[model samples]
Target: MTVRSLYLAPVTAVFPAPARTGQGGAAVYEQQRNRTSDADDSAARADRVVELLGARDEVELALKASLGGLPRERDETLARMAEVLQATAQGLALDAAAVWADMPERVLRNWLAKDPAFAAALRSAEALAGAHGLAAGPATTPTPAMVRVAVLALSRGATWPQAVAVAGFPVRGFRRLSQTHPVLAALVEAARRARPRKPKNFVPAGYRPRRPGQAPPGPRAFRLVRREDQVLP
Candidate 1:
């Protein structure tokens, strides 16, 4: 116990710098990835999203101006810019949705319910809440108008909501009429018992012919699988 003790002093002399070796230059490897995210874009992007939706400007301007300096905007120049812009605007392009002109009324209706800005537009229009009566659902399964629309829509090839709108019934106040119309009750019973439609065969995507501008695809384009008047093979 009266022996010696080792000093805990630090080593001051540096070793040969270890030949400056450690998996080569990790700096270059780490820098390989692009670290830019949308958050890094100009501070005005939020304003741009709202502005584009309101100004009703072409999507190209929105993409170029709003997404300026972003890789997607640059890469999109070579492809179908409209399609690309549209996809980006679907969920995040809150205001741009107004420009989806071809979207059906029923689809727009549902979207308005889910989107606050769109819902605000409906509120301003004063027709958003009960416009389709779906929020309340139906205490009873279906009313006369609902049944009529349902059968017509289902039979004539419309979506459920499409039939609801096309038949022109107040979805909310429908119960009021349900008691007045017995046929509607019967129609629901019929619809509930009716057979469901079969799924149609799909046209393969890659099956193009050698010739360009060949007379456009016939009835298939119109979704007419086989008409009685169609010339047979």
Candidate 2:
């Protein structure tokens, strides 16, 4: 089974809420979670996703195993593998992010060696991911990788464009990188210390800094209710 087939189903699973009836005191039911894939099947799928994420490290060897015999005859596998990796990244949160976090340059290069689509996508993705990784930094003029990473961070509310302030870039490069790189940029953005922020309309005009052990506001919450008569017969 494809890695995409395994993890993506969960993301689409909406957070369930208590179902309410519209009229006539009808029974209400929450939307059901997909159970077609059993626990055993899910465990198996998770294992496969882990394997593929690791395979990215030895992409050449894995590609050789998947389509080595076909070589030029089989080009679709490259796209298939890339698609799986991308799906795992977007759908599965912890596992997918962890898998990619460990992905290094050496492993990616190894994978790119065997397949042409991977070779091309890797080159593009590398430029994007790498540039993004760099852009997550404090650099003003960064490599394409940084720009890609920045866009990804911006997409997720992690970082702001004004921080880097690159106004002009060519469309040929296809900064679609933002859609791809957020999972990593978030980490980089989080590491940066938050600048000392000024209080914004928070404290009142006469707001006074309370000293330790000082009196504080009280009665934030109160009850207004009455109990019905429960006299026993």
TM-score of 2: 0.19
State the lDDT at 9 in candidate 1: 26
TM-score of 1: 0.22
Q: What does candidate 1's lDDT look like per residue over 162-191, in tens digits?
A: 445444445544445545655444343333
Tell me the lDDT of candidate 2.
0.37
| Positional deviation of residue 90's Cα in model 1 after best superposition, in angstroms | 38
TM-scores of all predicted structures: 0.22, 0.19
Give the C-alpha miss distance for residue 49 in model 2, angstroms: 4.6
Give the best candidate by lDDT: 2
**Which residue pairs does candidate 1 place in steric collision?**
none
CA lDDT, every prediction?
A: 0.36, 0.37
Indicate the residue-level lDDT of 162 in model 1: 47
Least accurate stretch of 10 residues (summed lDDT) in model 2? 90-99
